[model samples]
Target: MRPVDFEYTSPTSIEEVVRSLADGGGEATIMGGGQSLMPVLRMRMADPDLLVDLRRVPELKQVREEGDHLVIGAMTTHHTVAHDPLVAAHAGVLGQAAASVGDPQIRYRGTIGGSLAHADPAGDIAPAVLALDGAIEISGPAGARTVPAAEFFHGPFTTALDEGEVVTAVRVPKHTGWGMHYEKFAQVAQSWCIVAVAAAVQVEDGAVARARLGMANMGQTPLRAEAAEAALRGAPLQQGALHDAAARAGEGTSPAVDAAGTAEYRRHLAGVLAGRAVTAAAGVGG
Candidate 1:
């Protein structure tokens, strides 16, 4: 399949990108690494009049530490994030999840901003970002503003980004000493996860002080397992305690029945994977 003819422009500045989007009258699509959009375009899922490319924007490719957060530029590649020392030290969950995205080629070509903006429920990175309580910075004709990661996704393949708006960076709180793990179940290597859980635990004096749980492919959007998280808090850092908390993993989720598995199967996987992820993070078991 071939995409329809469209005008393309590679802009070095955000202002120019916004101007191009504005000129296209809401019919423009922004291209970061193009790992996701290229497939969508070739399949004719979207037909935009203009394509605003951000690959030339130097400012969007930087990863820096600001205050208490590690700020990752929107155009930063997954490969860079996976191997970056700053990211590994500050946000290990993100680095672990980024390292598991697709394959080496996809990781080299895919961008964090692109993955979050695409808002796929099965994407590995978004779940880890959600568990880390990340935020996204958006720039548009109106100005710049921030959106929390929890509120960024609207539905599968949809987000809160409006016309003329571009994601400039993602800000994640540094979990310097916390234990983190991303557990995924896929049919084959390099395949999308059928069910995955991202867990970050802060253990204190042999007790779980704080726990964050994010589920992938559990609903229309990546969701936080609030019930499970609440149950884990103050619990002992043991396998039995973690298993009990993970039992409620699918309490509020709405998984879909698909070729990967049935809804019931996914719900079961959620609890099983949550136990594994949380236990691994807490160092309760291998």
Candidate 2:
């Protein structure tokens, strides 16, 4: 099934892309690396009348630091992030997650903004971003606005992006003293994760100072296990506390049944992987 007829526009500027999308309104879709959107179009899952290509927009291709956050342009490819020393030093969680997205070819072409905008619950970056409390910056006719990572994802393949808006960049908080771990359960390297966990923990004197845990493929969106987080707060970073917290990892989760894993299996995995992630972040796991 080929895509329906559509008008293509390669906007050289972010402003041009925003205006084109505004002009076409709901009939338009932004194209980044086309790793996800192309498949959506080919299968007729999405049939936008206009394709606003963002390849020419230089604003969407930067990686820099601002204040306490690392600002990454929406068009920066996964390959770049996975290999960049700056990203590794500042946000190793994202770098680790980016290296696991799809395969080498996909990583080379797939953009972080595209993956976040696509909003697949199984996608790697969403959970990592959620764990990091990242922020997304968007541009539209109304001007620019920043959205918290928790509010960015609304549901499966759904986001807070309104019509005519484009994600310009993502701001990941600087991981100065946090220990990070990204643990994924997949049958193969390129397969989607059945259950994955991204954990960021700040430990001091063998106690958990702060913990943010994000689990993927556990619900409608990348879900942060509030129960698990609550359990870990101010607790001793020991095996007993980690196991106790892991039990609550899937407390409020209702994962979808798919070929990858049953809901029950995924729920069980949430517990297992959450333990692994937290343990790893606490520097207790290999």
Candidate 3:
């Protein structure tokens, strides 16, 4: 399917991109890797007057360490994030999640910024980012600002971005020695996750000191399993403790029923996956 006629502009600088979006008002769409936007365009889901391309902005394609966080440029591809040694060392859960997105070709073209901006409830990266408590950097006509991952997604296919704002980078605090895992359940190898869990656990003296759990496709937005986290704090790293914590995984979730499964089924998967993910991160067996 061919998309409607639209003006396209590739800007070399973040400032230029902001100006282009501001000029187009709300009739402009920002194009990152085009992995998600192209499909939307082909389906006529979005008919913007202009397409502001960010490919020419080199600064948006870098990965570096800054202070306590590892900053990843929005244009960094999933393949790069999945393979970069720096990312693997600092945020292994993010790398594992990126490796699970789509197939090889999709990972080669999909951008981290693009996935976060698209805010798909089933996207693999969102849950990992949410679990890591990452932050998103944005640039716009007004200026630059940061939004925490928890506050970034408003709902499925929705975000906190305002008109003329483009995501420039993502910042995640270094978790050099933490145990992390991304657990996903899908119908096929490259299909969207029916339910996914991202877990990061910090152990102390054979006990679960801190745990972060993020759920994918469990709600309108990627959600943190706060109740599960509370239940696991200071608990022994054992099968019983993991199951007890995971039982509360669906406490505050509102999952949707679709062709993949019913709401009840997803809620059940949430608990089961959470237990597996947490135990795996903690290096405990059931």
Candidate 4:
């Protein structure tokens, strides 16, 4: 299978990319790293008249601290994100999730912005960003705007990105001293997640003082396990409590039944993995 003939332009600046997208009317799509877009092109699932490549945009490759948040450029590779010391020291849970994506080659080429914009329910990065309460930075002809991670995903493969808008970076507030964990069950290391759990926990007075939970493949979008997070507050970091809380991880999720497994099976896996993730993040069982 081959893609339809399309004009391509690699813009070295965000402004140039924006101008190109505007000129293409709604027929052009931005390409970041191309890990996701290339496959779709090969399968002919997408046919854009123009492909605006953002790889040459220098601003989209910077990773740095902004105030109390870590601002990672949209074009930053998973490899760089997984190893960035700033990420490790501040939002370690995000780094843990980035490290778990696909394998070596894909990680080297895949990007956080691309993954978020791809809006795949099973993507590893979105759930971690949700758990970390991060925000998405978007740029358009209207200038820039920030959307909280909680409001980013609208549905499966759908995000809140407006037409002509591009995700410029991901901003995560510093959660230093918080223990973090990411757990997912896949058929193999490189396969999509059947279900995944990302947890960030803060302990005080020998109990879970605060908790944030994010679930993937358990709903139409990457979701925050609000019920489970509520249940964990002031809860002892014990197996029974953690298990009880984790069981609610799928309380309001709507996972689809597919060849991978039934929706019920995915719900079950969410709880099981959430337990492991939260327990580990809480520093309880080994």
TM-score for all models, in order of appearance: 0.98, 0.95, 0.97, 0.97
Go through the candidates in order and give the clash count of each: 0, 0, 0, 0
Candidate 3 lDDT over residue span 98-196, tens digit each:
999999999998999999999999999999998998999999978999999999999989999998899999999998888998999999989999999
Model 4's lDDT to the true fold? 0.92
Q: Give candidate 2 misplaced runs (Cα > 4 Å).
A: none
Clash list (residue pairs), candidate 1: none
Across residues 197-254, which tens digit of lDDT does each residue of candidate 1 receive? 9999999999999999889999999999999999999999779988889878888789
Q: Between the candidate structures 3 and 4, which one is better when assessed by lDDT?
A: 3
Q: CA lDDT of 63 in candidate 4?
A: 93
Q: What's model 3's lDDT at 265? A: 91
Work out candidate 2's RMSD over C-alphas: 1.5
lDDT of each prediction vs. the true structure? Answer: 0.92, 0.89, 0.93, 0.92
